[model samples]
Target: MKDLLGFGLRGRLREGYTAADFRADALAGLVVGIVALPLSMALATAVDAPPQHGIYT
Candidate 1:
């Protein structure tokens, strides 16, 4: 459904941003960062940049 992937957030914000939404989004972001950080660091290394720059990016 469109709501599952995209438009739900805009609609929700139009209504209100509640505490539950903040907690859920924060948890999702934490999980995504844990999974993506290493891959990004590797990408930075392949590009000959320092690893920390990947986080800055």
Candidate 2:
């Protein structure tokens, strides 16, 4: 399972993830989430499902 999803924090820490990196990553994630929320809802709507399913998904 770990191999399948290779989001390794230990490796990132070893590679020196600093405060600036955290800030940048956080901002980037926020932007992506903002865009994805409506896109996900649109996808659910396209399939005739409730918009909330996008959040669960």
Candidate 3:
């Protein structure tokens, strides 16, 4: 995975990312989950159903 990102003639410019990149990615995913929560509720309500039903579907 690191080698793929670093692939290019400009090795210095395209250096592989560190552990910080993975951490940031994980945090972003969590934020996305939080953002989706309300939208999921609204969708289930629109269909006259519970939020967990929407999730299971």
* Model 2 lDDT-worst window of ten: 1-10
Taking the tens digit of each residue's C-alpha lDDT, what string does model 2 give over 1-57? 473437887778779999999999999999999999999999998999999998788
lDDT by residue for model 3 (1-57), tens = 355655563574458655788699899999998978878887998989988876664
What C-alpha lDDT do the candidate models reach, one value each? 0.88, 0.89, 0.76
Arranged by lDDT, best first: 2, 1, 3
lDDT of 3 at 36: 85
Error of 2 at 12 (Å): 4.6
The all-Cα superposition gives candidate 2 an RMSD in Å to the true structure of: 4.7
lDDT (C-alpha) at residue 39 in model 2: 95
User: Which residue pairs show collisions in model 1?
Assistant: none
- Candidate 3 local distance difference test against the native: 0.76
The predicted structure with the larger TM-score, 1 or 2, is 2
Decoy 3 TM-score against native:
0.61
CA lDDT of 2 in candidate 2?
Answer: 73
Candidate 2 achieves a global lDDT of 0.89
